[model samples]
Structure formats: C-alpha cells, structure tokens
Target chain A: MTTDGSWRHTAPERGDAVTISVDGEPVRACTGETVAAAMLAAGAAFERDRSGAPRAPLCNMGTCFECAATVDGRLLTRTCLIPAREGMVIKTPGRL
Target chain B: MFDLAIIGAGPAGMSAALTAADHGLTVVVIDEQQRAGGQIFRQPPETFAGSVLHPTAGYGWATELIRRFEADPRLTTEFGWSAIGVLHDDAEPDGLCVAINHPEHGTRMIGARRLLIATGAYDLPVAFPGWTLPGVMTAGGVQTLVKAQKIAPVGDVVLAGAHPLLLLVADLLIRDGVPVREVAFAQSIPTPVDMLRALGAVPGHLRMLTETGAILARLVRKRVRVSSRTIVTAARGTEHVSRIELARVDRRWKVTGAPREVAASHLVLGYGFSASTELARQIGCELVFDSPRGGWVVAHDERLQTSVPGVFVAGEPTGVAGADQSRAEGTLAGLGIAASLGRAVPAAAFAEAERGIHASTRFSAVVQSIFEPVRGALGDLATRETTVCRCELVTRGELDDFLESSPFVSNVNAVKLSCRTGMGPCQGRYCENSVGAILASAREQTIGLGGRFSAHLPIKPVPVGDLRDLDAVTEQPASDGSDTGRSAS
Candidate 1:
C-alpha cells in the first residue's frame, strides 16, 4: 500500500496537526487539509465498494463522488470537500 | 433571498459572483471547495493560505479576484457546499430555488431572485483496462491534489491521454520535483504546418502560444518528452497502479502497434472534459448537443437565459470552453442577470463582454479542434473485461451481456436501470459517456443525449440526514443578511 508519506507538499509545514480518528483509530492530520488528503497521507483507503474492493479518492474534486465517506456520522459525506476539524471522526466502509 | 445564487465558485462562478456583486447585487456563491479559485486556479486549504503557491498560470488574476471577492461584504461565499438539485416553481418568485448541502449545515434550500448555473466541468473519465485501479486517476485530478491539498504523487507517474493539459501538468509536477515516468499522447505530435494553422486559429492569443511553448521547452529540458501517438491500453496492479501497457495509435487514434508494458506506480489521464449539465438539465433547461466541446449543453437565448426564463447558465454548462471564455461568459451572464432583474446595465458594458466572449470563443474552438476530436474507436479500447462503470464496478462483459439480452435497448438510461451501470453514488459522472459510447458501438449508432442517462435529482447522492431534518432547519441568516439560500418548494 502507498503510505501517507508517499504524497507530500512542496510547501514547508508551519501549522500544528489536528487529531481525527480514521475508522475508529486516531490519526493526526494537518488542519485545513481534507479528510481524503489525510487518508492519502495515512495510506488509508476512503472506503470499500459493495464488492469489498478498497476505493480511494479518484476525482479529488467533488464530481466523481468516489471519495464519499462517513464523517461525524453523516452518511456518505464527501471527505474531499469536508475540511478536517479537530476531534472529527471519519468512518470508511471497513477494509476487507 | 439573494439577488443571485451561483452554483460553482470556479473561474466562471467567481467571475459571475464578482460581476453581479459589482452591479450591487447581493450575491451568494456556493462551491464544494474551501476557496474561490476553481480547478484552474485551485488553492490549497486555508492553512496554507500563507504559503506561496506554485504559480503555473492565472495566478495573478486568481489572487486579485479572490482578494476582492473575500473583501466584499455583500457577497456570501458558501464553501464546502454541494448543490443537490434545483426546484423551479412557476407559481413562486424563487427564480428556480437551489437546494444545497454541507457537512456542517446539513441540507438547506436557498431561494435566489436570479440563478446562474456556473457549475464547471470535470475531467472526462476514459475507461480502459485496469483504469479503475486505485492509483489510476484523472491527470487534472492529480493536479488538484497536488495544487490544493499539497499532496504530490509518489514514484513513477505515467500520464496518459491526448490533451494539452497533460503537457502542462507534466511541466507543473516536474517543476515541483515530482518524477514523471512518461507522458503518453494518444494523438500524433503536431507538425510545423499544424502548429502554424493552430496559431492562425487563435488570432488574438499570442501569449497563450508562448506560454505553451515555454511549457514544452521545460519538459524537453527535464528529459520528459511526450511519447506521441501513444495510448495507454491498460493499467495492471493488485492494490495500486504497478504497470501500464502502451501502444502506438494512428492519426485517427486507431491502435496500430504491439502493446508494451512499463513499470508505473501511478497513471494520470487527461482525455479532455465533459459538460457538467446536471444542474442545468435539472432546471428543465433545453439542451443541445455540442460534440466537439461540452456534450448536451444547455440551450440559452441572447441574454444567456435558458429556456426557463430568469435562469442563466455560464461556463461549462453552456459548453466546455476554457477559463477565458468562461470568465467572459460570466460577465455577459452577470450583465444579463442584472438587466433581467430590472437593473440598468449600460449597453457599452454588454458590448465589451460580447467582444470578450467572441475572442475567447475563437480561441476555445481552435484549441478544442486540436485535442477534442480524433478519438476514433477509442471507446473500442474497453475489452470484455474492462470496468466501464467505476462506482458500480460493472464490467464491459456484464454491460455487453445485458445489452445482448435486452436487444432492443434504445438508450443508455435503459442500460443504466436494467444493468445497474449508472446507479452508483456518483450518478454516472465518471461512466455515463463511456457507457453511452460502448452502447452506441454495440447498437452501431451514434451516441446522442437520448443514448445517455437522463439526469435525476438529487444530482449526486444526498445523505438521508440532509433529507430528514429540512423542516426543522429554518431560514438561516446567510452572511449577516436576510439573504437565505433555501428556496420555498
């Protein structure tokens, strides 16, 4: 699996991290970046499709709707559009 | 109610917002992104607002536009909001009510006195073998990740597809120290005569030509020359893109060479874009097919108003013209909206906007002519095993089987309902065109709007939570104003 560190920014980091749980496990994410980005950063899949194959973000933009995950118990919330807030909980369809 | 509620905050939406606001209209701009710049000038998250963004192009305009937009007190910007549908009632004065949802705001229906659907286009999804794999993504999508979220691709990135944006993206990523494995252009390299003709096609845009030349030069210097006449026939991997299969194609994009495999951890595709006609179509706006550009574009009258009067569409909704045309159209639409709302917009401003539109439209047509066509039998690339629908994980074999059984299936929507091709959460944004193309090929007929799935509302999947508590959510005061976005259905 491609690790979260595989994708990185050219910009230097200055902000502190926010703690958000991914699939019930706590993951520290950069504030203001998206939950989907944090998932990519953590090398986590967004969710499993009905076939149980792992699905990550494809469009990154809102058009594809592939990045929809459960955030704060809101079903099928678009993780790409939702900014990661402190103490936010993101639940993806469990990995197979 | 706001004077105007714009659907997208991309180039056209932002421009329209500014134009409408400058005309002293209380404008409400709703977008899914956190910032005003659309995909073209996509900004990083607000945390990185302090960081110096890598300027590819349109940097100055975006920065200036965003500064003015954020400073304006009259404009209400709703970021991270996804539009669900439009409810147009002739009985009410809600000028076609807009329904939108956010993670925090839940779902709310906003009423607009005037509506402008500047909903921009997205990268066209091209289905080939293993294209649905985890790491195979839109070329522009990768750019969005890198540009907006500061997330760059790791290891061997192979960008495939026949669009100028591929070269520009290659240049952007390479400049930022990302290693690109190769760029596979599905079309042949342009000859000197072809280049001259293209230059002639853009009579007023020498700067764009020079900018493109510079990008090419940088790619050459970085030893990242594009492989012309080549197309990615397949991607192979278990978890992520591990190998990409390539083959040379003729001028008509017919596969002509033995396929070769290259090690690739990722694949970026730029097969051009399609019109985001969901919102416009939902409003019952009349649509016409514009094959070379935006497909199934909304039909608009002289004032940019759709068949549904008081409803306006600009940018990709009208057609998939680029940012310049989008911005010009935004100005035209904004002026038209103001005039329609009984505001006295000067005639000279209308003329200037029209002039701008003409110049940009010429440039858009020229650029599109270079890249949009020549996908000859490109749809034929999807073999029996390829996954045509990404959301449903429906394979070509399944689609073919369904088609064979329902031999008289006249349109793609039937295939969508019977075979579950467009039933996924995405509502077929990624698969509709490819599925339509395959069905068209199966029927041996040209694909038309009829051959495509009719857009159903909520255009995208809306959460039941958004749908459940709508009556309890009162008219939330937007931007310190009585200007609420919810439409009275």
Candidate 2:
C-alpha cells in the first residue's frame, strides 16, 4: 500500500504520530485522527465488498456506514466514529 | 425528568440550550456525533492537534455559541447519543420520553417536560444509474470528509448536482488541495437580472457573493471545467467510479443533448438537503410539504412549537433556511419554552429574535429560489434500472412495476411494504424523498402538502443487545400502573 502521504495535506500542526495496524500492516496515524482518516491518508481503502471490490469512505459522517471495518476483532465498527488510538488493530473486509 | 431536552447539537440546539439555560431552565442536549459543533461548524476531537478553521465567514458566531454552550453549568451535553424514538405518556401528560442509544450506555430513556428537535438535514438522494457504486457519494459527505476528518478522496474528483452547496464544496476541496476535475451544475448560474432582483431582498448577502466570487476565481485559476445546466446521468465503472456520464439539461432539468462521459475517480452528488423529520413525525408532529424548504418539514407555529404540545422543532427540522435562521428560531423557541415554563423572559428578546428570523428567512428565500432542485430533475435522471433505495437495493424499475401492479399503493409507506424500498439500515432517510416524488408523479398528483407515512420508533438502527437492556429496564414493574404503557410504542 502507498503510504507516501501524497493524499494528505500538511496541517498547521499535527498531533503525536502513532502506529496502528491496518490489515496487520503498520500505518502511522496522528492522535485524534479518525481511523477512516488515517486509512485514507495512508492510501488504504476502508472496506471491500463480497465481490472483493474496494470501497472508500463516503459521508465521513457516521450516517452512510460505508466506512465500517473490523477493529480489534470486533465486527462492523464505524471507523469514522472511532478515534485512532496507538496500536489499534484495523482489518479491512478483504483481509478477513 | 429534565425540564427541557434538545435533540441535535447543531447551532439551533446549542443556541436553544444556552438561551433556555440562561432563563433558569435545566436543559439536556443530545447529539449523535461525538462532539458539539454539528455539521456546519464541526470541530475536531480535542486530541486532534491541528486547528479546525471554519470554512465559511460565520465562525465567530458559531464559536461564541459553542463556547457558551460548553460553559453553561445548567446545560448537560450528551455526545454520541442517538435518539431512536419519542414516547408520550398520559400519566405525565405534558412530559415525553426520548429513547436514546449509546455505544457504552446501551439504551436508556430520558424524560423531559419539553422536547425540542433541531435535528438538521441530510443531502437529497438523487438516484441515477450507477449511483449505488462505491465511489459516488453525497456532496455533504465529501464536505464532512474534508472538514471533520481532514481527509479527501484521492484521485480525480468531480462534483455534479444542483444547489449552491456544490460551489461551496468545490471551494473546500480546492482549498484542501484536492484536484477537482470538473463541476457540473444541473441548473444554470442565476441570470444577471435574477441576481439583481434577489439582491433587493437580501442586501446583506454580501458574504455569500464574496465567497462565490472567490470560489469561481479559484476554479478559473486552477483550470477546473465548469458546466452549467448539466447533470450526471450515469456513472460507469467496474468496482468503483471510473467515469461519469453528463448531459445538458433545460430549465426543467430535462436532458437536451447527448450524454458525455468524463473520467473521474470520485463523483460527488448533491441536489440540496431534506429535513430530517423522522423523529418529529414519529412523535406526531404535523408536517407540510414545501419543496424549497427541503420537503416535508415539521409544521411549527411562530414559537417553533409543533402541533404536538410541548414538542418544538427548530433548525432544518422546521425548514432548510441555513444556520442563521436556525439560530434565530432556536432563540425564539428557547424564549417560548421558558415562557411556557413560567420563566420571565423579556418581551424585547422575542422581538429581537423575530427580527433576526425575518431577515434570515428573507435571505433564505432567495437562496431557495436559486438553488432548489429543478422540478422533475431526479425523475428525469432516474432510469428504469437505476437504484432508488440503496439500503434495500430497490430499483426504479421495481418501484414503477410495483406502482403499476399495486394500484392502491398511493402513499410512501405502502410502496415500502410492497417492494421493501426503505427496509434498510438508513430507515428510509435517504430514499424517502425520491420515492415520495416517484409515487406522486405516478399518481398524477402534485408533489406537495400531504402523503407521508408515519415514521416508526427506533428511527435509527439499534443493536439487539441495547434493545434487551431497554427491555430489562422496562420489564421492572412501574411503581404505579400509570407507567404500564411506557414500553416501546
């Protein structure tokens, strides 16, 4: 996965960066960043459908539920609603 | 039981809480989001190190409202609480119960003597072929991704739809350094004559004019293609959006030319917003169909109180007049609620709020005339195979077939029963407006005034575990026989 930060704009300031696992691959995230934001910034798709088609986050508000992922073994957690904590495990549906 | 309960933490709810609390009424404000600023001025989490600058010019007012709301001791703010249902009790007569669900708290019921619903609006779901594809999303969704999450969908992005919000979203994306390939507006930019006429009603709309000018300048500088009187008829891609088909449309939004395909990775569709009246409808608020006001807004008197006594609606729940109107209505409702509770509210306060509301309403009327979705726009774009209801995967063809076969299906609820149009996780929030339009058109009836199905409880999807917890709470016999009917209605 591309984690070069091409999609991320430099903010005026950033919180402390921490590492989180996406599909068991370590991805860097800033404190207070949503899991969905971290994944999108790191060039990771939010989830995959039964057809193995990658789905990106839409309606970053929790309404769409399109950004749901398995977090720390729990299923269908809304990544957009969850703050990215250090060492948190996020697995996309394709990985599962 | 709280003296007052406000749903949604947007400007309206926050302002109401502040005004009511200032008048000595204890208030509890509940919101579904994790924080107080609601969508317009949504703030990043406290843990977020980056500053969240307001995208528009009214940051001062929003910041002041949020600051006062946070500092008020008499007001309790509950974040991450989704109101699922509103219940009326004969025993309490004037009091009502709000069923709320939190991830940590499971399910709980809060009783309040007065209920104010300021639940805002959501984007009007416009169905066309391939709208169900992964890469297509509402423009508000895109704005949320950028504003709240500080993230943008990578790759080529194009915004297609009607409404001035499309311009605002383009400005936001451009500011965030997102590459916008094109923006296709289904309605042409207001004619010079129209703009001149509208200015007479809203001379204070200088901020909007400046903002629009800045956005247009940036779009021109960046070489982003802008097409007017055009609409996205279809999205073409295998897994996600790869290209979108656009066609020119006339004033009524009827296609007048051949469709053209444009390469895009993400397609943002916004045809303006629809009021979230589900909770109001569920609690028996009378509704009126006003398309320019975002369709089927909960009916309210001058005091913002609905037909159901003790229940008030402000903000977009009453109409889509933007934040200023929301704040004005919220202040008025707060004063009204305070007076109803026998609190002393100065007469001048009501006059001031009414003046503000009148000015804002006048400005909003100009906006609605210019940006409201053109009549027959959605139906014009909808194809037989186009998906109307994403949650239930109902297609336009299926809806048409059902309407033809079941002649008795005159209302939205009957259509839901016949084809499961709204039986998905969204609880018909996304598709109800479109389906209502389709139903009205099929019956050759003018699409306004009446014909909405009563919204049911559990307006939001809740976990079975939460329901069980609620069951446990209700199963305990009430101390009095009067509480027997308090179980889920």
Candidate 3:
C-alpha cells in the first residue's frame, strides 16, 4: 500500500501522525487530514460496489456523496467532510 | 433574532455580513462548509500546515475578508450549518425564519428582519456513459481536493470541460505535482479577434487577461497537452475509469470528427455551473432564465433586493459571476438592508458600490459569453445507455423512454416522480439540470419550464431520527419587535 510520503509531493507538516483502521487494516494519517484523504494517501479504496468492486473518491466535496462510508457504525457518513481521528474504524462499501 | 441573516459564508455572504455588521446590525452567517471560505476561497483546516491562502493572486483579499468576518463582534458566524428551509409570513413585519441543521445541534430555527440568500452555485450536471465511474468528477471537485485538502488522486488525470475553470484546475494539479495528462476544452480556443473583443468589452480588467495568460504559459512550459473543441464522449472503465473517449465538436456541440481514446486514471469534467437556487426558490423569489448568467437566477433589483421585499440575493444565487461580482453585489445588498432598517448609509457609498457592481457584471458577461457550454452539448454526449442520475441509477434511455411513453410528463418534477431520477440522497443536486435539458429537447419545449423544481425542506440529507428530533428543539420567539405569534411551528 502507498504511504502518505509515497505519492505526496510536499512533506506534510501538521500535528502528530495518527492511525485509522480501514476494514480492520491500520492506515497512517495526520491530524488534520480527512478520512477520504487518508485513504487516498494510503492507496486504499474508500468505497466499493455491491459486487465488491473498488471505488475511488470522486468529488471530494460532500455534494457527490460518492465517498460515503460507514464510520464508527454510522452509515452514509461523508468521509471527505469529516476529519480522521485516531483508532477510527471505517467500513467501506461491500465490507458490511 | 438577527437584524440580517445571510446564508452561505462565501464571498457574497461574508461581504454582506461584514458590511451589515459594520453598520451595527446584528448578523449571522450560516454556511455548510466547516470554514468561512466557500468553494472558491475554501480554507484548509486550522491544523493544516500548508498555506491557508489560495496560490492565485488577488485571492489575498479573501483572506483579509475572512479575518475581518471572524473578528467582528456584530457578526456571528455559524460554520457547518446548512439552511434547510425558509419560512416567511406576509402578515407580520420582518417575519422570516431560516431552518438550519447542524450535525451536533440537530435542527434549529433563526429569525431575521431581513434575509440574504447567497448560497452560491455548483458544477453543471453533464451526463455521459461511464460518468458514474469512481474516477469521474467535476473539475471544481478535484480542485477542492488539491487546494483545500492538499490531497491529489493517484495516477494520470485529465481535465475535460467547457469553462475557463478547467485551465485553472489543470494549473493547480500541475503545481501540486499531480500527473495531469491533458487539458481538453469543449470550446475552441478564442481567436485573437475574440480575445481582443473580450478585452475591449472589459477595458480595465487587464489582470484577468494576465492571469489567464500566466496559467497558459505555465501549462505550455510543463508540456501539458491542451486541446480545444474536443469533448469527452464517454469515460470507459469497470469500477474505476481507465480511459476516456474524446470527439471533436462544432460550435453547436454536434460531433464533427472521429472519436479517439486516451488513457486516463481520473477524468474531470465541468460544463459551467448551475445556481444553487433552492433556498431562494423556497422563499418564492422570482426567477428568470438567462444562460449567460448560468441558467435561472433570482431576480433582484439594483439594490440586490428580490421581488419579496427585505429578501436579497447576492453571489452565484443571483448569477455565477465569480467572487468579485458576488462581493460587489453583497456590499450593495448590505447597504440596502441597513438603509431599510433606518441605519445611516451614505449615498456616495451606495453610488461607489453600484459602479463596482456594474463593472464586474460587464466583465462577467464577457467571460460567460466565451465559456458558456454550447446548447445541446450535454444531450449530445449522453447516450441512451448513459446514466443521467447516478443516485437513482436512472439512465438516459430510461428518461427518454419515460418522456416518450408518458405524454403528460412534461416537467422535471414529474420526471423525478416517474422514474425516481432525483429522489435520491443528493436530492437532485447533481442531475436535475441535465435532466431538464434532455426533457426540454425531447419535448420541443423551452428548458425553463422543466428547470423549475420546487425545493423541499431539509435541503441536505438528514437522518429520520434527527428530523424527528427537530420537533423537540425549542423554537426561539420572534424578537424582531413585530411578532405575529409565530412559534417556529
């Protein structure tokens, strides 16, 4: 999996690094980074179709809702609109 | 209760709030975004280490406006609050209520003596085969990811669209070290004569021209392929987009050349913008059709007050004329609101604001003329198999079939009901405009009739549990001094 430092052009200078789990897999993220951003940075699909097809984040704005995923048991939460926190559990589409 | 309640914290709302507050008027600016800057000047998170300011020149003005807006004591800024519905009573004086929903606070109501709806606009909906693919998105959407979130999508990206914003997004992607393979514009590059005419139309706006020139120069230096009069006919892929097909089109957007395929991991498409007129329409504001102004816009007077008195509209809600125009209109509306409330505003100040508005509107007209999508362009790209409404899985064929079979179904709302085209989580924000266009063309009727869809309460999606709790939230009594005993019921 791609780390935040792999595809990033500039070094992130935010607060302490945090770990957020996606489908029980730990991913590294910074404090201010959004859940969608963290997943994209880590090269993980933020969504999946009913047939288990991987879906990337489109329209990072909350309007599209293409990046919606279950966060901490809440369904349809927009990952792009919410900031990532330590130990947050995210279930992508089709995972449930 | 606020003396003036402004929706949206973009250039227009912020300017209006700042101006109104400077006059000692109690004001509240409600915005859906977490920060004060709306889409154009959206700021990064406070903990974000990257520069909060936009890299583009002249945007520094936005930073100053945001700072002043937050520091002003008279202005109460409510971020992460979406204005769901508006209630107005003709029987009472200044009887206007704005229903706002906050993630943590549930639903709450705020009363205002005067209201300014500056909710702004979103990307125009353009449907095509494979548009629902994970990698396909609007140019503005991708720009937000890079500018506000500082996150770039991995792999090769292509910017395909009709507006000047495509160039801007491409420039940002290149600056952020994203692999932008090409920048494709649906309209042909302006001829020297056209450029000269545009410049002549907006005589003093040399900075606008210089900025465009600089972006083009950088793209040239980076060897980014720039094509014009080419449109993405289809985005081809399985779960995610892997490639796109481009076809040349004429001024009327009719296909004129053979289609060619290009490898791409991400496809960004923008066909201008559509005004977010739901709030204004909810309050029964008069709307008029003008393509140059980005479809239907709230009809307002020189003072920026709508036909409904004490109700004003600024920013993209009035028209998609960019931030400068929004700010100018906002200032005029603020002054008008203050004057209505018996506050002393100098006539000279009003005149100065009017002059600025006139200049910016003129410049906007010129830009709109050049960038407005060609009529029928979207319809031409959308095939029967193309997904028109992603939320409902409604395809172009289904809509066409519905229109063909149901002779009584003539408007957009009926289409929405018939096939659930817009009854999804997005609430028709993404597909209504495109569906309106297609239905209009198929029925041989003007697009305006199909474009008029009434906005219901809870403009954004709210859970059923939260909506049920709305009744429990105590409603604040009307404090505008002329209450007709409305209790937010």
TM-score winner:
1
- Ten contiguous residues minimizing lDDT sum, candidate 2 chain B: B474-483
> Which scores greater on DockQ, model 1 or model 2?
1
Candidate 1, residues B153-252, lDDT tens digits: the string is 7777889897888888787789778888789988777878778777765665666677888988887788885799899999888777789999988887
Worst 10 residues of 1 chain B by lDDT: B469-478
Q: What fraction of the native alpha-carbon contacts across the interface, defined at 8 angstroms, is recovered by model 3? A: 0.40
Encode model 2's per-residue lDDT on B1-489: one tens digit a residue: 677889999989998988997787778788887778778777866665646547476435788788777776566666877888888754577777788876545687777889999998888888788876767888887787677766666678889988778888988888877789899988877899878868777556667777778889889899999899899999988767888899989888889999998888789988888888899988888999888999889998888889999999999988898988898888999999999899998999999999989988888888888888764568657788877876666888999998999887688888888788777656777677778878888887767622775677777766666666543332212232123233331
| Two-chain DockQ for each candidate model | 0.57, 0.38, 0.41
For DockQ, candidate 2 versus 3, the one ahead is: 3
- Candidate 3 C-alpha lDDT tens digits along B64-157: 8889887775566667777878776443566677788765466777777899998988888788888877778788777777787777766788
What is the TM-score of candidate 1? 0.94
- Judging by DockQ against the true structure, name the best candidate: 1
What TM-score would each prediction reach against the true structure?
0.94, 0.91, 0.92
Give the lDDT of residue B105 in candidate 1: 70
lDDT of each: 0.78, 0.78, 0.78
- Report lDDT (Cα) of residue B239, candidate 1: 70
Q: Give me the displacement of residue B59 in model 1, in angstroms.
A: 6.2
Model 2 misplaced regions, further than 4 Å: A1-28, A46-56, A69-77, A86-96, B89-91, B471-489
